[model samples]
Target chain A: MLRALSVIVICGTAAMASSQSNPPNETRSSPATVVPQQQTPTKSTAIIGLDGVKEKTAGTLNVKDGKLCFVHSRNKSQISAAAIADVVTGEDSQRVIRGTLGTLSMFAPYESGRAISMLRSKIDILTIQYRDDDGGLHGVIFTMPVGAAEPIKQELITQGAHTTIQTAAVAARGKQ
Target chain B: MTNFFRITMCSCLFAMLSLAGPHLHAQRKDTEKIKASALKVEMIQSDQIAVPAAFQVAVYENLIQQLGKKASFLHVYRDGDRDAASIPNLVVLHTTVSRFKEGSEEMRQVTTVAGATSITIHCRFTSADGKLLLEKDVNGKVRFFGDNRKATYDFAKRASAVVSDKFSANGQS
Candidate 1:
């Protein structure tokens, strides 16, 4: 009886050991299984173009203060807000500025910093308007990086926009 | 012997799995970080104004000429009247200060004076309406032998060149 009991004890121990090594055939949850759950989702905002503003394939979209903001990813350095001066919505969305030649050249000093300084340029606040795909309109305030304002303005003119180059003092406080 | 072998195999498998977890997690985190740093700028509009007075106008016009077709000038009073008027891409404020003296000493003193005078212009740029695009204070020493127009013209020309270079570099029209 003592020998028989010893064999039974050894057999039971072997079975338990085998079970522990292979785990259970049923789904055995591990502490490691919860690790994936620990990862949190990261959210980012993007700006998308709508309606009159032709949407570029590579860009981002975001809504700020109730206005839709569209940013083209190709020129990652350029950022425009929904509000710009003289935004016209029709078949195409356009921003218009009316001033004399002197005003146009006034941007020189701001541009100076661009050439000599590493700091990003700051543009004054202008009005911007958004036209939705379904013909809805939204307006927002916007600022551009310095130096970029002129090129965009020029492009608008070249596109047959009636750009009026005007003269005025430098931007005044609270004017932008 | 069977029990001992089973125990050894389980321990080896756990150890390998544990080692791989951190590397996989780290790789994912790195990818998320890269997507956060990109930014872009979009332009809206610009307005520029010229300094009044004939000497200033002469100086300003000479400067505008250097800007080529990139910029133009207008009288300040008519800036707001939008009767089929074109909007300026930028606005420039020009002022001329004359100090009669000889050589660099005169220029140095004028620089200090000009610097003080520029505070108002700087403030305007900071303001919402002025939207001061650029400001350049040019000091001309009205020499007995030198033409003030020429001196002012030279200063405006240099400033315009600097501004134009910046505009082009920024990808402005």
Candidate 2:
């Protein structure tokens, strides 16, 4: 009885780990420049906060040519890294979406996908402050899963905006 | 042992989920607070505009509509009200049309289906004491398929952002 139970437990652990996320390949460090027709690109839909404005809008944060692209159903001149002057990971954002996901886990403990991320107790948000062609400063806010934080940080680093973590740890780690 | 592990994980997950309700409620309250302001929109000048007579009026009308619709503040008043300017706190706006170009038939026939239409304007926002708060040369363009006056729409859109972004309700810059 003990041996059969052990086998089941080991299998369950292996299956759970596999289901969480695929192994990070080298492509994560360098996302492809062109999106393939057959493959659907992963995306993060977020509530965008425009600087100097009191209201917020819904948009998707996408990666285009290794630079972040902010697009909505409406709006022109999609914002890209070239427009961004600073990238700040929100240090004190109260992301209610993650909290709401955690609350739902009470009824569905087996919730996977986006819910599992809320277990980390952190709402990972990327607050990008960019300048428009007119030299006006605008702010954009995006909510992303914690799993996507590293790749985004790396991408922004390539564009010259240092993530909060890397900027803080630069002294101890030297050059990255 | 397997059942015990499942029970332990489920219990932990459930407990954390239960605690999130109050936290989420607190966050909702934080974003609701907004500051309001009272602003005055003066006339949109078109003395030097080279466009058609209707085009100028259309552009002027469009700018007023956009500023009223998109900009968020305590109150927005048009210039004709004499009593409004004398109020304790009043911000007056002065605008001058700098440049304008009607849609080009050549570009529409040769390169773009819509051609290019553009407009530029200078704006100054001030307090009742005539103290200048903000001055900026705002412009807009419509190069794609759209109405020629969309250039003004574009200009108004950009100008509204300037107004909403620079000032706040408490009169603090």
Candidate 3:
């Protein structure tokens, strides 16, 4: 009778221990490390295309330890360089003055609004498509100075990112 | 008597055939409609308007997400996805921003009537062979609350609503 009681207690303890050992997967499946976006000290605007981080953040982006990281304020987000499937770059232009000033300028009298619209500055856009741990595809787009995105693309390619279009070819396509 | 019975059987068979013919035709039409329900969202184009890169990207991404949630396309394909080419009755969506006004969040919060962000996109849905399906000019606006990017979300929702109202998805209207 004592042996039977001992066996029952032992089985219950083992079952409880096994159940506790398998924790629930409540955490999201994303890259573990974070990376910065700006290569230089000046931070650029980065719009993260991931599920959680979907806002336009001002940050410095860089490739550190084979990961593309974006450091904004106190937060950091990264994706593995090897996981990037495609890199596409585009060139566009925006008004010289932006935000509230730009929008308000549209209300200027007569042809002033039209003339202010003509004062445009060229910009570069970089888009990166990468996969997460679960093999889910994600994309990110960031805009920088006219000549900034090309070097970043080169750095990403050197660090194992993939791209189908050459830098010059992309520039030409954007022109078209 | 045998001849009369044969005649009667022939009449009954013809009656059944006539009754079932319209039903079969309707079913075939439904099948064709479902086949054309597959949709592929192309990247938003801003060649005409000087839309910010962020707004362009936001529109494209939000449209894809909203279509999946609101519309019932058999399969939704992203831009440049290779698998979309082989789809038999794929519909491609092309969006061009006609007008965009970037508003200030602080201004909107301070003076709700003053700062209003608005976007107007010309959405064109076409077949795989470049045949036009449906085209409409949709407008989205954020008058009071939320960021300027919320206009993109509004535009996506309205576009998906248009698609859902027009196209039959998964054999249901």
Candidate 4:
């Protein structure tokens, strides 16, 4: 359903971009495709959040009856099509270290503090780029269970998306 | 279908569609935007704290990350960018860590199933004209998992919640 809106937006923005002399500065940071005038709610258990931050709650990202909804904590955001310039998604890993250290301490692999420092990692991250009604470019990212997010991710990409994978940070962690 | 039934059905559908929109009734929404709050968030600064550089870096990066997550601003820049501040109608943010607790994760694992780590941030939102729009002490705490930097994430959310409430003319918070 979100992808449906993206297609509409892309068609609209393409038309507008041709007639206009200068595109709004906001759309320049990332790919800004013209998007739907409305959105509806979607269903599925995936972590969702806004801009470059993903909240803890896991749910679907969709537009329900014209309202942009990310279920789980039931966060509903209102952004008009005119407010948005594009929608893009990508993978992000914001690592954390609490769990890895607690267990690693038992084995005494190395120094406890160093082990903890090396282990921190982000489980999942879903990044999005958008423009608001005022044409201010913005982004929101989410993280979800890798197993379950395939469908949701594919749908958004097929609808019109630019995808990038974060470089593996494990090497850096190992070096540390 | 009977003519009366068909007509009645069409009218009902039309009523539902019209009811769904204010524009359909010719009621124009108040689109007037408050210019003062329509700011491009440029620089975010925080007072130096006597904490681990790693923790401070986490907090700083998280705050910038959270602010960038909002799809409202035309642009959001990091601290080192000197040129962003020169833009018109720029909004600058200042934060200070008034209270901090470097919780021991080892103590947490040994003591109980959950541990407490937290940080309190006093955030100030100011415009180019030197007007203070929001000043709030936001708290971030992580109990079971993650590290003290989790406190930074919580603080970022809490601070953004406060700032967005007052900053967006559309009430984006």
Among all candidates shown, the one with the greatest lDDT: 3
Of candidates 4 and 3, the better by TM-score? 3
lDDT digits (tens) for residues B55-151 of candidate 2: 4444454555577777765466654545465565677778878887767522442244556877788898887789887788998888853435567
Model 3 TM-score is 0.53
TM-score of chain B of each: 0.35, 0.68, 0.77, 0.66
iRMSD computed for candidate 2:
18.7
Q: Which candidate has the top score in TM-score?
A: 3
| Worst ten in a row by lDDT for model 1 chain B | B33-42
**Candidate 2 lDDT by residue in tens digits, A99-148:** 45544533442322223322222334566655555453344555555445
The fraction of reference A/B contacts recovered in model 2 reads: 0.00
Can you write out model 4's per-residue Cα lDDT over B54-126, one digit (the tens) per residue? 3454565566667667524535654435555567656766767777777755345334354588787777767
Tens-digit per-residue lDDT, B60-168, candidate 1: 3344344543322222211122321333333333333423222321122223233111101110111113454444443433332222334544554555544443343
What is the Cα root-mean-square deviation between model 3 and the actual structure? 20.8
Looking at model 2, the pairs that clash are: B37-B74
Cα lDDT tens digits, model 3, A1-176, are 65565565545544544443332223211112212244553356776475555566677777777787777777788888898887766655455656788778656553244344444555567888776664545668877766566667766776888886656534454589
Q: Looking at candidate 2, what is the lDDT of residue A7?
A: 60
The order of the candidates by lDDT, greatest first, is 3, 2, 4, 1
TM-score of 4: 0.39
Q: Once superposed on the true structure, which residue ranges of model 4 sit more than 4 Å away at CA?
A: A1-176, B1-49, B113-115, B169-173
**Chain A TM-scores in order:** 0.24, 0.46, 0.67, 0.38
Q: Which runs of model 2 end up more than 4 angstroms from their true locations?
A: A1-176, B1-36, B105-110
